[model samples]
Target: MKKNIKNKLNNLKASDNYRVRRAKDSGNSHIFRFKGNDYLSFASNDYLSLANDVRIVESAKKALDIHGYSVSSSALISGYSRSHMLLEEELSNFLGQEKTLLYSTGYQANLGVIKSLASRGSFIFADQLNHASLIDGSILSRANFKRYEHKDVKELESLLNKCPDSREKLIISDSLFSMDGDFAELKELEQSLKKYEAKLLIDEAHSLGVFGYQGRGLVFEYLLNKNENIFLTGTFGKSLGTFGAFFSGNSDIVDYVMQKSRGYIYSTSLPIHTIEATRASLKIIEEEDWRRDKLFSLIRYFKNCIKKSNLTVLESDSHIQALLIGSSADAIFFSDELMKRGIYLPAIRPPTVEEGKSRLRISLTVDHEEKDIDYLINILDMISQNLVQ
Candidate 1:
C-alpha cells in the first residue's frame, strides 16, 4: 500500500498538480509569515478581516475562563450547552429562519444535510460546480443524482421537468461559486423550485458575512429566505473569522436534521471558546456596515485595475477573483513569481476546477489597501507579459 501511494504521488508530481502545505510562522489580517519573511496574502478567506480582531480574541478568552475548552461529546449526548443554544437562537433570528443547527465544519454540514434529506426514490438536482461536499453527500444518499450546467437555470428547469413528480426533488447549489466567484441566480432558481414543488438547499459558505444587508447572505439579499422550501447553510470560518458551520430552515426541517444527520449526531460539538468567538464575530457582522463598504470598494478597485491590464479575469461581484492562466504549470509559475515579489496568491488547479482552466485564486480582504491592489495588478501584468515573451 505504501509503494502504491508513492507511485501515485510521483505521477501527480510529474503532472505539475501535486500540492504541499506551507507552514506559516504567524499571520494577521491580510499578511502571513513564511520562512521568516512576511507576505501580503491574497489566499485567505478572511474577507471581513475579523479573524484576528482583538474583541473576538477577548471573547474567546472569556469563554475559556468559564467553559474550559472541550465539550467532549456530541450534542445529542452531553456536549450541547446553554452557550450553543444561545448562538443557535441568535443565528435563527439573524437569518430569519425558524431554527438553526450547528455542525463541526462546512463540509460536514453539506454532507449531513444532503444525506439526511435524500435517499432512495429521491432525486437530487445539483449544480455542476457545487462544492465537493455537496457532490459527495449526493453520492452517499443513494439517490438519483443529476448535475446541471453551471448557473444555467434553464438547464436545471429542463432536467427537473424530466423527473417524476412522485419522488422527492432536492435542488442543491453553492450560493457563491468559490472558485469562479460568481453568484447562483437564486430568484430564477426559486421560481423553478416553486414550479416543480421542489425543495432548495443552498451552501452559503462564501456568501455569509460578505454579501447581503447585515451580512445575512445571498438568500436574504434576494428575499429567498422567506420561501419555506429554502434551506440555508453557512460557515463561520470565512467572513465570520471563526470556526464551525450552521444549517438553517423551518422548525420541522431543523428538528428532522437533528434526529437524522449522522455527521452531527456522531461528532463532538465545537469548543465553547470557538462558539463564543463566533458570537463576537456575528455581532460585528451585524453592527459594522463600514467593513462591508470598505470590502466592496476594494473589490471594485481591483476589478477596475484588472480591466486595464491584459489578464483574463472571471466576472465576480464577490471577494474571490479568478485570473485564468490556462495550464497547471503556467498557473504555478505565475503564483511563484508573485511570491518572489512578497505576494501570496495560490494557483488553483483540477480537480478543484475544470481541466485546462487552472488559474490564480485571489481572495481580497477589507484589511487590504488600494495600494496593495495596485501592486498586485502591476505584478500580475509584468508576469503575464514575461510569460507571453
Candidate 2:
C-alpha cells in the first residue's frame, strides 16, 4: 500500500499538480506574514476582510469565557446548545427561510442535504462544474447522477425529461462557480424547475456574505421570495470570516433532513465561541456596507488594470477573479514569479480546475486598495513579457 501511494504521489508530481501549504504567521487580511517576510496577498476568501476583525475576536473571547471550546457531540445528541439554536434561528430569519440546521462544515451540509433528500430511484442532475462535495453527495445518495454542461439549463432540462416522472428529481448547482468564477444562471435553472417539476439545491458558499440583497444570496436577488422547490446550503468560513455551515429550506424538508442526515447526526457541533463569532460577523456583514463598497471599488480597479495589461481573465460575477495561465506548469511558474515579487497568489490546478485550464484565482477583499492592485498588475505584466509558452 505504501509503495502504491508513493507511485501515485510520483505521478502527481510528474503532472506538476502536487500541492504544498504555506503557514501564515499572521491573521488573515490583505497582508500575510510567512517565514519572516510579508506578502501582499490575493488568495484569501475573507471577502469582507472580517477574519481578524477585533469586534469578532472580542465576541469569540466572550463566548470562550463561558462555553470553553467545542460542544464535543452531534446536534442530535448532547452537542446542540442554545448557541446553536439561536444561530440557526438567526440564519433562518436572515435568509427568509422557514427553518435552518447547522452542520460541521459546508461539505457535511451538502452531503447531508443531498443524500437525505434524494435516495435510490431518484435522479440527481448537477452542473458539470459543481463542487466536489455536491458531486460526492449525489453519488452517496445512490441516485442516478446526471451532469449537464456548465450552466446549461437546457441540457439539464433534457436530462430531467429522460428521468421517470414517478422518480424524484433534484438539481444541484453552485450559485457561483468558485474556480471559473461565473454564476449558475439561476433564472434559467428556475424555469427548468417549473417545467420539469424538479427540486433545486443551490450552494451559495461563495455568495453568502458578498452578493445578493445585503448578502442574502443569489436566489433572493432573482426570485425576491423563496420558492417551495428551492433549498440552499452555505458556509460561514468564506465571506463570514468564520467556521461551520448550514442548510435551509421550507420547514418540512428541513425537518426531514434533520432526521435522516447521517453527517449531521454523526459529527460534533461547532464550538460555542465560533458560533458567537459568526453572530458578530453577521452583525457586521449587515451593517458594514462600506466593506462591500470598497471591495467592489477594488474589483473595478483590478479589472481595469487587467484590461490594460492585456491579460486573460475568466468571467466572474463576484469577487473571485481567475487569471487564465493555461497549463499547470505555466500557472505554477506564474504563481512562483509573483511570490518572488512579494505578491502572494497560488496557482489553481487540476483537479480544482480541469487540465489545461489552470490559473491564478485572485480573491479581492475589503482591505485591498487601488495601489495594491497597481503593483500586482505591474508584476503580472512584467512576468508575462518574459514568460515562455
Candidate 3:
C-alpha cells in the first residue's frame, strides 16, 4: 500500500503537478519574506490590505480580553456570543440581506448552504468552473447536479427547462470566478432564474470588499433583490483580510439552514476575537473608499503594462489577473524564474485550472503601488524574452 502511494506521489512530480508550500516567515501583506529574503507578493488575496491594520488588531485584542479566545462550543450549544451576534447583524446590514449565518470557513459555508437547501429530489445547476466547495456540496446533497459551461446562461436555462421535477431547483455559481478572475454574468443569470422560477445562490468569496457600493457585493450592484430566492455566501479571509464566512439571504431560509446544516451544527463556532476582528474589518471596508480606489488604479496600471509588453493575459478587469502560460512545465519555469527576480507569483496548475491552461494568478492589493506593478511587468517581460530563447 505504501509502495502504491509512493508511485502516485512520484507520478505527480513527473507530471509537474506536485505541490509544495513556501513558508512565509512573516504576516500577510503584498511583500512576503520567504527563505530570509523579501519578495514582492502578487499572490495575496488581502485586497483591501486590512489583515495587519492596527484597528483590526486592536479590536481582536480587546475581544480577547473580554471573551478569552474560543467560544468553546457550537453556535447552537453554548458557543454563540454577543460578539457573534453583533458581527452577524453588522454583516446583514452591510450586505442588505434579511438574515445571516456564520460558518467556520468559506468551504464550510458553501457546503452547509448547498446541503441545507438541496436534497435528493432537487436539481442543482452550477457553473462548470464553480469553486470546488460548491461542486462538492452539490454532489453531497444527493441532488441531480448539472453543470453548464462557464458563464453560459443560455445553457443553464436549457438545463433548467429539461429538468421536470417539482422539487427544489437551485442554481449555484461564484459571483466572481476565482481562477479566471471574471465576474459572473449575474444580470443574465438573474433573468434566467426569473424565467425558470429557480433559486439562485452566489458565492461572493472573492468579490466581497472588492466591488459594489461600499463593497456590499455583486448582488447589490446588479440589483438582484427582487425576491427571497437569492442567497449569497462570502468569506472575510480574502478581501476583508480576516477569517470566517457566511451565508445570507431571506430570514426563513437562513433560519432553516442554521437548523439543518450539518457542517455548521457539528462544528465549533469561530472564536469571539476573530468575530470581533471581522466586525472591525467590515467597518473599515464600509468606510474606506480610498482602498478600493487605489486597488482599481493598480488593476488598470497592471493591465496596461501587460498589454504594452504583449504578454498573454486572460480577460479580467478585476484585481485578480491570470497570466496564461500554456503548459505546466512552462508555468513552473516561469514562476521559478520570476521568484529568482524577487517576485513570488506561483504557477497555478491543474486541477485548480485546466491542463494547458496553467498560469500565474496575480492578485492586486491596496498595499501595492504603481512602482510595484511596474517591477512585476518588467520582470514578466524579461522572463518572456528568456522563454523565447
Candidate 4:
C-alpha cells in the first residue's frame, strides 16, 4: 500500500502538480512572514479585512471567557446553545429567509443539503465550474445528475427541458464562481428553473458580505430572493471573517435538513466562541459599508491596470481576479517570481482549475492599498514581458 501511494506521489511531482504546505512564521492584515521574510499577500480570502479587526478579536475573547472552545457534542446531543440560535435567527432575518440551519463548515452544508433533498428519482442540474463541494454533494445524492457548461443558460435550459415534469428537479450553482470570479446569470437561471418548476440552491459563499444592499449577496441583488423556490448557502469564513456556514430557506426545508442531514446530525457543532465571533462579524458587515466600497475600488483599479498589460485577465467583477498563465509549470514559476519580489500571490493549478487553464488566483482585500495594486501590476508587467521574450 505504501509503495503504491509513493508511486502516485512521484507521478504528481513529475506532472508539476505536487502540492506542499508552506508554514508562515507570522502574519498581519496585508503581509505575512515566511522564512523570516515579509511578503505582501494577495492569496487570502479575508475580503473585508475583518479577520484581524480589534472589535472582532475582543468579541472572541469575551466569548471565550464565557464559553470555552468546543461544544463537545453534536447539536442534537446537547451541543446547541443560545449563541448558535441567536446567530441563526440573525442570519435568517438578515438574508430575508424564513429559517436557517447552521453547519460546522460550508463543505458539510453543501454535502448535507444535496444528499438530503435529492434521491434516486430526483434530477440535479449543476453548473460545470461550481466548487468541488457542490460536485461531491451531487454525486453523493444518488440522483440523476447532469452538468451544464459554465454560465451557459441555453445549455442548462435544454437539459432542463429533457427531464420529465413528474420528476423532482434541483438546480444548483455558485452565485459567484470561486476560481474564475465570474457570476452565474442569476436572472436567466431563475427563469429557466421557474419554467421547469424546479427548486434552486445557490451557494452564495463568495458574494455574501461583498455585494448587494446591506451585503445580502448577488441573489438578493438580482431580486431572486423573492422566489420561494430558491435556497441560499453562505459561509462565515469568507467575507464574514469567521468560521461555519448556514443553509437558509423556508421553515419546512430548514426543518427537513435539521432532521435528516447526516452531516449535521453526526458532527459536532461549531465552537461557541466562533459563533459569537461570527455574530460580531455580522454586525461589522451590516454597519461598515466602506469595506465593500474600498474593495470594489481596488478591483476596478486593478482591472484598469491589467487592461494595458499582455496578461489575460478573465471577465470578473468581484474581488477575485484570475490572470491566466496556461500551464502548471509556468503558473508556478510566475507565482515564485512574484514572491521573490516580496509579493505573495499563489499559483492555482490543475484539479483546482481545469488543465491548461492554471493561473494566479488573486484575492483582493480591503486591507490592500492602491500602492499594493500598483506594485502587483508592475511586477506582472515585467513577468509578462519576460514570458513573451
After superposing all C-alphas onto the true structure, candidate 2 shows an RMSD in angstroms of 1.1
Q: How do the residues 28-142 of candidate 3 rate in per-residue lDDT, one tens digit apiece?
A: 6598899789999999899899999999999999989988978899999999988889888988888888899999999999999999999999999999999999999999999
Candidate 3 has a TM-score of: 0.98
Q: Decide which is better by lDDT, 2 or 3.
A: 3
- Mind giving the per-residue lDDT tens digits that candidate 2 earns over 154-252? 888889888888889999999999887789989988889888899999999998888877788887788734798998999999999999999998999
| Model 4 per-residue lDDT tens digits across residues 44-93 | 88899888888888988998998887899999999999999999999988
Report lDDT per candidate: 0.93, 0.90, 0.91, 0.91
Q: Extract clashing residue pairs from model 1.
A: none
Pull out the clashing pairs in model 4.
none
Best by lDDT: 1
Q: Which stretches of candidate 3 lie over 4 Å from their true place?
A: none
Which scores higher on lDDT, 1 or 4? 1
Worst ten in a row by lDDT for model 4: 24-33
TM-score list, all predictions: 0.99, 0.98, 0.98, 0.98
For model 2 the local lDDT of residue 180 reads 79
